[model samples]
Target: MRIAVTGGAGFIGSNFVAFFCKNHPTDEIVNIDKMTYAANPMTLEFLEIYENHKFFKIDICNFDEMENILNGCDVVVHFAAETHVDRSLQNAEDFLTTDVLGTFRILEIVKKSKSLKKYIHISTDEVYGSIEAGSFTENSPLNPTNPYAASKAAADLLVLSYLKCYRIPAIIVRFTNNFGPFQHPEKFIPLAITNAMENKKIPLYGDGTQVRDWLFVQDTCRAIEVIIDRGKTGEIYNVSAHQERQNKQVLFKILSLLGKDENLIVQVPDRVAHDRRYSLSCEKIQELGFEPVFNFEKGIEVTVKWYERNQQWWKTVKDKDEFKKYYKNRYPGL
Candidate 1:
């Protein structure tokens, strides 16, 4: 099988690449990535030795370039997008271009291809906005509160439209927040860990009461592999670890794991239109023989240890002037 993966250099994308390379050793993988600020080539460095793995540094918005590279691939998993909520809130143009328009370009190519077997779009549970009381099912109406979520929701609808109008075997899998290695330091878990590592204050937005379902990266990778093989066309699957916890709870856990004092946490201004809670009804995906084997406590420990031991790996980027500027811009008062 030939598989073309966009955004293969990003957080979840890089992890998925390693997962695919190990599980599908005989399959050809063409990893097309834009190599954005969040992506590092070192993540996929070992895969260079494998004959079945190939990397192409290209932007997905360039339809002509993507069309040329994706030809003859049996499956195209579109994971490319500008995912940071704070960045999107600051400026939505990038999200619209990369998340919505970029996806349209990929779908256009797949629409004309006869060799394509499936196109799996990686979506987030944030499209449903927030649920303070219960979980959101796949059929729930999309009420995206933030620009990033709205852009992803738009792409999701576009994918469904192609399925209906062009008869493309496209699938969408909406996953909750994922945490593990190779994740950018700006994200919640990594940010907290890295901040604690340097004895810096961990920024907590909006009272730190926001709730989220945290899923390990490996479990999400395995689920995506299953979806590529067994997921039905034009279907949306929701996957979660059901490890829902408030932001403060998770932060305290990080501090506890690192043997740090809780006084290092500071309450900061909240994100624009921040959702209070996000939960997903993963019954549909679970019905397809999906399960999350990693418990939250264990996963957090492993993740904390990884960052604790790899200070050099993260320091190279976190200590950079570029990242410093962005970080300051994102958290001005902090």
Candidate 2:
């Protein structure tokens, strides 16, 4: 099989590429990434050794380039997007351009492709906004609270439109929060792990009570593989591990794993329009023989150990001037 993966250098995308290449050595993988700040080539350094894997540094918004690269691909997995909520809140234009327009470009290419058999649109549970009481099913109406989620919701609707109007073979999978190796330091899990490792203060938003379901990235890769092979077209699948944790709880776990003091935590102002909780129903994907391999406890442990052993990796990202500036601007006195 010939597969094209967008954002293949980003966290979840990179992990998926490695996982797929290992499981399907004979399959050809064309990795497309814009090489944004959140993506480091080092994350995919080992993939260069894979004879069947190729990398292309191209933005998905470039229609001509995307069309040419994805021409004969049997599968196009769309994972490219400006995905940081905080960054989106600060400047929404990037998110809108990359998440919505970039996805449109990919869909356009898929609509014209005769060899494309499957177009997988990776979505997020944040599109459902927040659920204080119960979990959101695949059919739940999208109610995005932030600009990032709104952009993704728009892209999701666009993918579905192509499936209905142009008969494009597409599937959407909304995954819960994913954490593991190679995640950017700006993100919650990696930030906490790295900061605690550096003996720096861990920044917490508001009271740190916001709830999120944490799915291991490898488990996410497995779920995506299952969906690619067994899922039906024109369908949306909610993939989650049901291992929900409060922000403070996750931080505490990280501290425990790293033997750090709780006093290192410093609460910052709450994010604008921050959702209090996010939960998803995984029944749809589970029906397709998908199961999560890592619970939060095990995943968090593994993630902490990875960060501990790979200090040079996250440190390089944290040491960048761009990251320092963003961190200072976002946290101020923290």
Candidate 3:
């Protein structure tokens, strides 16, 4: 099989690529990424030893380039997007351009592909907005609260439309919060983990009670594999580990793991239109025989240890001027 993965240099995508390469060494893997600030070559450095894996630094928005590269690929996993809610709140143009328009470009190319067997569009649970009670099923209506979630929701609809109008073999996978290795330091888990390593104050937004379902990155990768192997076309699968944690709880856990004082936390203003909670009923995907291997406790411990051992990796990312500039602007006092 020849698999083409977009945004494979980023956190979840890189982990998926690594997982796939390890499991199926003989299958040809083509990784496409825009090499954004969140994407680092070092994340994929280990793949250099794999002969069947290839990398292309290409923007998905460039329709011509995407069309040419995606030709003859058997499978396409679309993971490329402007995903940070805080960044999207600052300026929505990048989010709309990359998440919506870029996805449109990929769908255009995909609808024309004769060799493509599957096109998996990765979405997020944030698209359903927040729920005070009850988990959202795949049938729940999209109620995006932030610009980032709105953009992904638009892309999800576009993919579904193409599946019906153009008869493309496509499916959408809505994932909850995923945290593990190679995640940018700006993200919650990584930020807390790295911040504590330096004994720097970790920023907590507005009392830090927002709830989110956490999934291990590897478990997400496994869910993708199941979808590729047996999932039906033109369907939406909500993949979650059923691990719910509050923002403060997650930070406290990280602090406990690192033996750091809770005083290292700095309360900050909440994000614009921040959703209070995001929960998904994974019964749909579960029916496909997909189950997460890592619970929050085990997953978080593994993640903390990863940041501990991979000091150089996170350090290199944090040392970049882009990261520094963004950090200073996002949290001025911190």
Task: Tell me the tens digit of each residue's lDDT in model 2 across 90-166.
Answer: 99999999999999999998898999999999999999999998999999999999999999999999998898899
Preferred candidate (TM-score higher): 1 or 3:
3
lDDT of 2: 0.93
Q: lDDT by residue for model 3 over 196-244, one digit each (tens)? A: 9999999999999999899999999999999999999989999989888
Query: Global lDDT of each model?
Result: 0.91, 0.93, 0.93
> For each candidate, how many residue pairs have backbone atoms clashing (under 3 Å)?
0, 0, 0
Q: Name the regions of candidate 2 deviating beyond 4 angstroms.
A: none
Tens digits of per-residue lDDT for model 1 on 82-200? 99998898789999999999999999998998889999999999999999998999999999999999999999999989999998989999999999988889899999999998999
Q: Model 2 reaches what TM-score against the true structure?
A: 0.99
Q: What's the C-alpha lDDT at position 98 in model 1? A: 96
In Å, residue 301's CA in model 3 sits off its true spot by 0.8
Cα lDDT of model 3 overall?
A: 0.93
